[model samples]
Target: MSGGVIGTLGIVVLLVLLLARVPVAFAMFLVGFLGIWALNGWNAAMGLLGSETFTLASNPELVVIPLFILMGNVASASGMSRKLYDAAYAMIGQVRGGLASATVIGCGGFAALSGSSVASALTMGKVSLGEMDRFGYDDRLSTGVIAAGGTLGILIPPSTGFVIYAILTEQSIGRLFLAGVLPGLLLLAAFVLTITLLCWRRPELGPPGPSTTAAEKLRSILGAGPILVVVLVTIGGIYGGFFSPVEAAGVGAGMVVVYGFATGTLGLQAFWQASRESIVTTATVMLILIAAHVLNPFIALSQIPASVGAFLTALDLPPTATLLLILAVYMVLGCFLEGFAMLVLTLPIFFPVILQLGIDPIWFGVLVVLTLEMGLISPPVGLNVFIVKSVAPQVPLGRIFRGVLPFWFAMLVTLAILVAFPAISLILPTTMFG
Candidate 1:
């Protein structure tokens, strides 16, 4: 068989392994290595594996992963996430659907500190779900907000999603980071509007939370100030050109560490726990990146991307039509594949086509990450939905899924807006950096 045929077989074997519960990183690594050995030789495969692993591991830009992850973990350990939730609640809790709206705002704030969507979902779910429940918020709105809002962790500045996309596409991380800012806020606003309309229609879905006194509101804001400052300093530094993305990550991580200890919320035990968690998360991400690197060369040799590009070109579809089809495919895949796995599995084929169509990579990154966000709250494999369920065990899994539906539609609206106005994502990155 030809290299392309062997590559196709390798992908099929990979799907079988994944369905059989193989870990994504290991599964990709295995398929990639074996495919290369089949197409080239064992020596070439082994050589590629060793060199790629070392090269990816040794990449200095990768330092941002661990540092930003550590910053988030430590921030959680320090109770900063709770403070952010409280501040948002205090500011907006009295309005109709206020508590759910606050949860979205809180999730956005925490997203700035924690770039991982899982962490954002888990932490915000814990912090705000109960309060919304207490305010008699509908389970659907309460649970849905947490799951949907958690997605902001991947779209806001300091996002690991953007970081990984940058690494994969060889784009500037700072530019992607900036590009995400407006779109993230736009999505957050859409979520809040969803809640408002829900409450406006039913008037009971999200009952008004008690208003806070002026002093109480001030105190809550003050309480959340330190971590907010850290977020600002890091992101602002990057925007101002005072620091590179790697330097911003280091600064953010360092500041969070100091804040954790100074606040006394992160004791030695908690600190150690956060470190271990960060290390584990970092390792998982690094392994996946290495595996993706290994897989990319094999796929290149397989001519899969070339084949895909030629096929798409042969269709003679308009660029807009082709882009929409690709996005639709991503949305369908999102139902079954975890975002990172789908990203690794598909980008080699799709990214080249996107560029060939003259689409902006940074804008496409936002659209792609938004689709992944949808997947996180989507059914069958909605990771964030499961995370929210774990927080609210009494709420049926089905209810949580139902609750997320409106927010899912809200996400669709945001996606449409971004697609129509690419400038929403591109303005900050282009104006500030260009």
Candidate 2:
């Protein structure tokens, strides 16, 4: 068989395995390893292993992954999320669809602390889901809001996805984090507006939540004050150029720990549990990433990207048109593929085309993240939807999908705003960091 045929077959086999419930990293690794062996021989594959493992582990940029993950675990264990949700609810739960709106606000705030999409979903699902349920909101709207709001995890600052994107593309992590801020808030606002408009039309969807007295509201703010301070210290320090992303992670983790101890919310057992969980989770992610590192350059060496790029250029389309076409393709792909795998696999091909078209990579990264955020709620393989379903099995999966339909439209609107106004992403990064 020809080398090209072997390579293509390898990818086909990997997809088949993935559909059969194989793990993503394992699927990629099996295809890549055997493809190399089939094309050359076993000795060549053996020779590649030592260098691949060392190079992936030795990467200094990768160190930030565990630190950020640790910070999230610590913050969650310390009860920071409850305080954040209380504060957000107090401030906004009086508005129409108030509980749902507060769900979005709380998710955004928790996303800032955690920087993980799944973690944010799980945390908010446990806390805000119950509150919304108790407030007489529709089960669909309550769980759906938690599911949709959880996507903010990657949009907010200190995101793991952004860190991975920066590492893949060699962009500045600090700048990418800064660039995401405005776009994140814009998304949160769009979500709230969509909820308000919908519930206004159908009052049963989210009946008005009980109003908090001014004194209670003010008191709730005090509970959340530490988180706000941590946000300013971590994000503010990075944007103000006072600290690197790594340094910001340190400060954020330290502050959260201090808050936990001082408030006695997180005792010795909680601290130990958080530490242990952080190690396990970080290790799992790093292992998958290392496998990808071994696999990525081999895919690049196959010259598939060059072939794909040539085909895209041959279409003779305007740059904007090409991008729109690509976005549509990503949306279709998101229905079936995990967002992380899709991003990692396709960027090697598409990112080159984007750079060739003279687009700013930072602006494009934010756009890509927002697009991936949709995958968290899209049909067939929406991880966030599954998370909500797991929590509230009584709510049929069909209802959750139906519930997110309006939200999916809201995402498209948000994407349009980002596309039409690039500065919605770039303005903060350029002004603060440049």
Candidate 3:
């Protein structure tokens, strides 16, 4: 068989395997290994695999991943998230859909510490769902809000996905982390506004939490001091060049651990638990990454990205128009694909074309993150929503989907704003890194 035919067939087999519920990383690895062996030879394939594994494992930037994961786990287990939520709730819980709005605020704060969407979803869901349910909040709206809010885990600082994107693309991890700030806030605001509107229209969606006195609200604000301190210290360290991205992660982890211990929130058992969880999560991500690194050579050899670029460029469309088209494609594909797979599969093909079109890579990175965040809450395969569903089985899936519609529109608007004014995503990075 021709080499091209072999490559195509390998891709087909991968799709079939994925449909058959094989893990995505394994399916990708299997197809990649077979394709490389078929196109070249066993010795060459084996050499590339070994070299890629070594390089991926030895990467210094990757150390940040586990550290950040540890920071997240430590912070979550230390009762910091509960304080953050309590503070946010004290401020927002008096309004209609107050608890829901508070969930968004709390999730955004928690997302700062927890970069994994699943972690954010599970943690915040545990914190906020019961409160919302107790307040007679609609299960659909309450669960939906938690699920959608959790996606900020990947959009906000210390995001595992953004870190991986920076590593993969050879971009500055610090800049990417900075670049995510405005967009993350934009999504957070959108969720808050959506909750407000939903509650206004359907009062049963969420009832106001019991009001707090001014003094009590002030005390809650003070209680949030620790969370704010950690966030500012970590971000300031990164942006002020006091620390590299990896160093900042280490600092963050250290701060979280110290806080946990000093406050007596984390005992030896909790410390051990956080470390074990971090190791397991980091291992899973690294394994997938190593597989992707091994597969990338085969993908490059296929010339598929180049071909796709050529095909797109031949359309003679304006850069902005092409970008919109690409975003549309991302949204559609998101309904069926998980975030990491979608990114790895498309970045090679699309990133080059986007760069050639004179789009700023930093700005484009923000846009891509936003698009993938949508995938987390989107229907059919919205992983964040499913995570919430697993916790609240009584709420039908369709209700969650319907409840996210407003926030989705808000996200679309935010996307348009970023596209129209790239500075929204680029200003901080340019100012800080310049």
Candidate 4:
């Protein structure tokens, strides 16, 4: 049988395994290993298994993953995330839907610290849901805002999604990080605008919160100073060329740790717990990445990318139309697959097509990450929706899904805007790096 046919079969098996609820790493590993053995030989397969495992395990660039995760874990443990939420609340909680907007802002702030959608959703849901409930906010709006807003974790700087995309595609991490900044802020704004519009139509949806005095606002802002400083330093350092992505991650982690200790918020036991959680999360990411390495070579040997590229070229669709088709596929797949799993499964096939179309890798990375964000809140398997439900169990699953629908549409709009103006995703990287 031809390599293309073998590759196609391998993908079908992979999807079947995923549908059977097999872990992503194991599914990819099983398919990749068998496919490689079939296409090359057992000897070649074993050789790659050893070599790729070691190479990825020892990659210095990957260190950023653990560091950034630790920074976020520590921030959450240290009450920095709560303080950030309080600050946002003090400023905006009095307005209609302001509590929801503050939750969105808080989610964005935590995302900058965490670079993880799951963590952002989990942490922010716990912090914001009760507050919104107390303020007479609609459960749908409160839950929906947390579910959708948490997606900012992957679109903001220090994003694991961007990091994974960069490593997989051999793109520059710094450029991808910079490319995400403007687009992340744009999506956050879109969510806020959606909330405003919703409340405008039905003020009862999110009743106005009690106003805060100026002194209270100032005090709340000061309470959040540590996290704000860490965010500015880490992201600013990268743009100013003062630190590489890895260095920025390390610095951010260190600063958070120091703040946690100084404030007596992160005791030794809490610190240890946070560190352990970071290790587990890091291990999971590493395994997925290693499996992706093995799977990537199998796909290459199968010549599937070449086949897909040729097919796309034959269709003779314009670049923009072709891009939309790819993104639409992502949206459909997002309904079922976890974001990172989808990334590893699809990039090996779609990336080559993207390159052939003269698309900018940095811009595409931002776009892809944004699509991943949508998937996090998309129905069927909307991971963030489930997360919000976990926090607010009284709210039905379907209600959470309904709540997120508008924010999901907001994300769709944001995606459209970014697609129409590529510069929204590229300007920072070009101005800073070029």
Candidate 5:
């Protein structure tokens, strides 16, 4: 059989492995290694395995992954995340649906620190769920907000999603980080609006939380100062050209560690635990990235991207229509695949099409990440939904899914707005880099 045919079969086998519950890295690695061996020789496969492993393992840019993750883990262990939530709660908790809105704001703040949607959802769920429950907020709305809001972790600055996309597409990580800022804030605003409308309609879904005194609000804001400073210094340093992404990450991580130690919030045991967790999370991301490099070459050898690109060209659709079609496919796939897995599996096939169509890679990255966020709260494989469920075991899974539906639609609206105006994603990157 031809290489293309063999590549097709390899993809089928990879999907089968994924369906069989194999780990994503292992499945991709298995398919990629075997496919290269089939198309070339065992010697070629082994050479690539050795080279690619070393190249990715030694990449300096990848250091950002562990540092940012360590920053997040240490921040969580140090109670900074709780302080962020408290500040948001003190500021907005008196409005209708205020607690949920606070949760969304808190999630956004934590996302800037964490860059992991699961961590954002899990932390925010633990911090805000009980407070909302005490305020007599419906579990559906409360759970939904946590799951949906947590998605900001991937869209805000310091996002691992952007890091992976940048590496895969060979784009500037700083540009992608800048590109995500406006869209992330837009989605946050959309979630808040959704909460407001829901409370406006039902008046019971999320009742108004108790008002806080101005002094309490000031105290809470002061409490969040450490995290706020870290976020600003790191992200702002990147924007100001004072630091590369990796430098920013290192600085952020160091600052968080120092703050943790000084405040006595992060003991030696807690620090060790946080470091261990960061290492594990970093390992998982690194493995996926390494596997992607292997799989990319196998797919390239198969010429599937060329074939798919030719097919798409033949359709003669307008560029906007074509973009929409690709996004539609991503949305469908989101139901079945974890966001990053779907990203790695599909980008080799789709990214070339995007470039050929003259679409902006940075803008497309924002769109793709937003769609992935939708999937996190989407049904079936709704990963963030499941994360929230694990935190609030008493709440039915179905209710959590139902709760996310409105926020899902809200995200859909945000996606549409971003698509309609590419400038939303492009402006910051362009202005800053230019």
Candidate 6:
């Protein structure tokens, strides 16, 4: 059989295996290894696997993953996340729908610390839901805001989404992290606007939170200031050429650990718990990366991306049209696949097409990450939706899904803005380093 035909069949079988509940990394590894064997030979496949595994496993750059993850976990266990939410809430609590807006801001802040959307959703849900509930905020708005806002975790810097995208495309992780800044901020603003409009339309949906006195606001700010300072210094240092992304991660992790201990929030037990969780999360990411490396060579042997590129080129569609079509496919797939799993499975096919079209990789990374953010709140497999449901068992899953709709629309708006003006995603990266 022709290599292309075999490659196509391999992908089909991979999908079947994934749907049948095979682990994502394992499914990719299996299909990729076998496809390489089929297309080349047993000796080549074994050699490819060994070299790919060793190279990926030994890369010093990957240390950033565990450090950033540990920073986030330590922050969460130490109640630093709550302080962030408190700071945002104190600043905006009196505004109508302010609680929801605060939740989004809090999510954005924590996202800067933790790049995992699941972690963001889980942490913010615990921190913000009870407060919103106490304020008599509508269930839909409360749960929905947390679920949707939590998506910023993957779009903001320190984002695992961007990190994985960078490794896959061989783009600069620093540039990708910087590229995420504007788009992430834009999406966060869009969500806040969504909440404002929703509350404006139906005041009862989100009643105004209790007005905070100046003293209370000052106190909350003082309470959270140190951790916020740590976050800003870490990210700012990266942007200012004082550190590489990996170095920034290490600085951030060390500062957070020190803060946790100094404040007595991170006891021995808490520290151990954070370390264990970080290890598990880091291991999961490494396995996916290793699997991606294994699958990449098989895809290249297939020429599937070339075929798709030619098809797109033959149709002579505008670049924007082609890009939109590809993203639409991501949206459809989002209904079924986990975000990171989807990223590993699809970038091999789609990223090559992106480069073939002369698209800027960093800008495309921001746009693609935003779409992945949508998946976190999209139906069926809306990972954040399930996360919110877990946090608020009394709320119907449907209600949480309903709550995410406006924010999903807000995401679409953010995506359109970024696409229309690529500079929105690239300006910071280009200005600082380009």
**Order of quality (lDDT):** 5, 4, 1, 6, 3, 2
TM-score of each: 0.98, 0.96, 0.97, 0.99, 0.99, 0.98
**Lowest lDDT 10-mer window, candidate 3?**
2-11
Which portions of model 5 show Cα errors greater than 4 Å?
none
Off by over 4 Å in 4: none
Candidate 5 per-residue lDDT, tens place, 284-375, comes to 99999999999999999999999999999999999999999999999998988888888899999999999999999999999999999998
lDDT of 6 by residue, 277-389 (tens): 99999999999999989998998899887787788889898888999998898888887888777887788888888888898888888888888999888888798999999
What residue pairs are clashing in model 6? none
- Model 6 / residue 281 / CA error / Å: 0.2
* Per-candidate clashes, comma-separated: 0, 0, 0, 0, 0, 0
Model 5 residue pairs with clashes = none
Worst 10 residues of 2 by lDDT: 293-302
TM-score head-to-head 1 vs 4, winner: 4
Quality of model 3 by C-alpha lDDT: 0.86
Candidate 5 at residue 311, lDDT?
94
lDDT of 2 by residue, 257-323 (tens): 8889998988999899988988887777776676666556656656667777899999999988888
lDDT minimum window of 10 residues, candidate 4:
128-137
Query: lDDT of model 2 at residue 203?
Result: 91
Model 3: lDDT of residue 79:
86
The positional error of residue 132 in candidate 3, measured at the CA in angstroms, is: 0.6
